[model samples]
Target: MKVLALEGQKHIKSFIDFPHDLYRNDPNYVPELYIAQHDLLTPGKHPFHDHSKVQLFLAYDDQNKVCGRIAAILNNNHNAFNNTTDGFFGFFECINDQKVATALLNQAELWLKKQGITTIIGPANFSTNETVGLLIDGYDSPPVVMMPYNYSYYLQLIENAGYAKKTDLLAYDVPYDTHNDRSVRLLGALQARLKRSNIIIRKVNMKDFKNEAAKLRDVYNQAWDRNLGFVPMTEKEFDYLAKDLKMIVNPEFCLVAEQGDKFIGFALGIPDINQVLRKVKRGRLLPFGIFKLLFGLKKVDWLRVMALGVLTEYRKLGIEACLYGLIIQNAISNNIKGAECSWMLEDNYMMNNAIEAINGKIYKKYRLLEKAL
Candidate 1:
């Protein structure tokens, strides 16, 4: 068995293709867009490379068959913000072999050690800002957009590799049709109260999305300041992400809170494009794949509430509840089947209770594992 640094196009393609074969029999596995992954891993294309660095590695067995993959990451912002020398491991996927998993993780640790890092933490697909964590719970269904899905054996493999739980991220499931929605019952009252305070909630104006996103970026930085491992995104990074999201963002589900032109808070619920991508074999979008993604948008039945927050100073003023209510209302109106309010820190009681008040069940759990170097 051997571990190889993924550098050349051949190695890079192998890294991306390994998972497709790994999860082939897993009914819930959704193949992510190949082109998007390519761009993200490519330094000049993904903005994360501008401020940080990542090195992809692939593990191969005696017969030269790919067995596992990992990305050893040095998030400069994560260290500077937390004031700790912590490197990260992400993009991990492997066969159910302990040796393969161990080799993959050991390489990541050694790479991080070389970067002067004292601890290795992750499955952060580079950082907390992207697809982070190993899906340790809720394997009954496919994951929503931007979320991860892995087999139960992964937990044992990671633990066997000596990675301990650092923290768990939560994902709430709000079934639009079946669940009793307390948010809907209280939404009228909540909106009335917010109105009294001169606060207005409205759909994002696509005509002015560029300017609106700019303001919301500031709110995002401050709103999540207290979350574990969060680092404010650079301007270029935020803009790059905004542009990608805008391509799939439904204006009705992209909402904002304002008081006299000031963007104080926002909530983004994007259609679960995975419903379409599940049919896009190999995650390719050309030929028939593009048609599946295009015509399949209308049939997407769920929305992934990827983000929702208010500035710290303005929090707990019913703003969080109001945003959630609006998201639910819009989702129901659009006939969406469900909404996933996800990747929430497990310890955030205020937000957790708010979601509970709206009948959002804790349906999935993801964990970030760590090992002291």
Candidate 2:
């Protein structure tokens, strides 16, 4: 097998399409949107390229058939923010063949080494801010929106490649009926308690979304600063992501906590669009696929409680419980059957315990792997 640095639009197309072909027979595999993937991989279209560099590699067999693909990513912003000479390998996919897998990983390592990077960590499509980690468990069902799914054998392949686990990201399944209704019942009292402290929780206001997003961005960066591999997003990067989410965001599922006029925390839960996208063949939204996505929104029964964070100073003040409780309450009221509270750090006991308190089941686990260069 031979690995080559992706060069042209043709190669880029192949890099994006490889996963579809790789998982063609897997019923749980969900095809990510083709246009979104194209734009993300293109430098000018995505804000990530404004401050970082990514090199795509495609592996080919003796007959020149694509066998694997990987990306060597140097996130300049992350290095500058965290003070580490770290590199990342993401957008990785390979057949069970060790030779092809090794070649793809080697190519990425060689590319990063040439650029002066000393260590590597990932499966992060770009960064922790985006889709990251390998799905090591939970193959029984499809992933929720913005989460990833991969072959179960990938765990063995990555470990065999000498990558050690850097951390595990947790995903919990919370069925509405199973959740402790105590949180929902206490929602009113909790809000009143917060109000007594000059803090109140409210749905994200859509009419003033741009302004609200800017404030929430600050809370996001500050709240998640202590996380592993954490890096505050640039203004442009935050805005770029917020724009796409705005299209699918239900204001009711997006809540914010404030003290007087100061934003203290926020929780955002988006409908699992994957419920619709999974049926949109090859991730294309053309012809009938577009209709499926548009009409399928109302029928989406699951929610991905994608993000919930509070400023450091505000921790232990019941803000976390209030945020989570409110999201769960809203989900129930909307007829959403359940939600996935996910990608949590395994060591985040406060958050994990809070989820556990709500009776959320640890249904899936993902790993972030690392190797010294």
Best by lDDT: 2
- Clash count, one per candidate: 0, 0
- Per-residue alpha-carbon lDDT of candidate 2 for residues 1-373, written as tens digits (9 for 90 to 100): 7899977565888998999999999999899999999999999999999999999999999999999999999999999899999999999999998888888899999999998999999999899999999999999999999999999888888888889999999999999988887777887888788888999999999999999999999999999999999999889999999999999999989999999889999999999999999899988888788999999999999999989999998988888888888888888889999999988999999999999999998999999999999
Cα lDDT computed for each candidate against the true fold: 0.89, 0.92
Model 2 residue-pair collision total: 0
lDDT of 1 by residue, 185-204 (tens): 78789889889989988999
Candidate with the greatest TM-score versus the true structure: 2
TM-score of each candidate structure, all chains considered together: 0.97, 0.99
Model 2: ten consecutive residues of lowest lDDT? 6-15
What lDDT does candidate 1 reach at residue 85?
A: 98
Candidate 2's displacement at residue 324, Å, is: 1.4
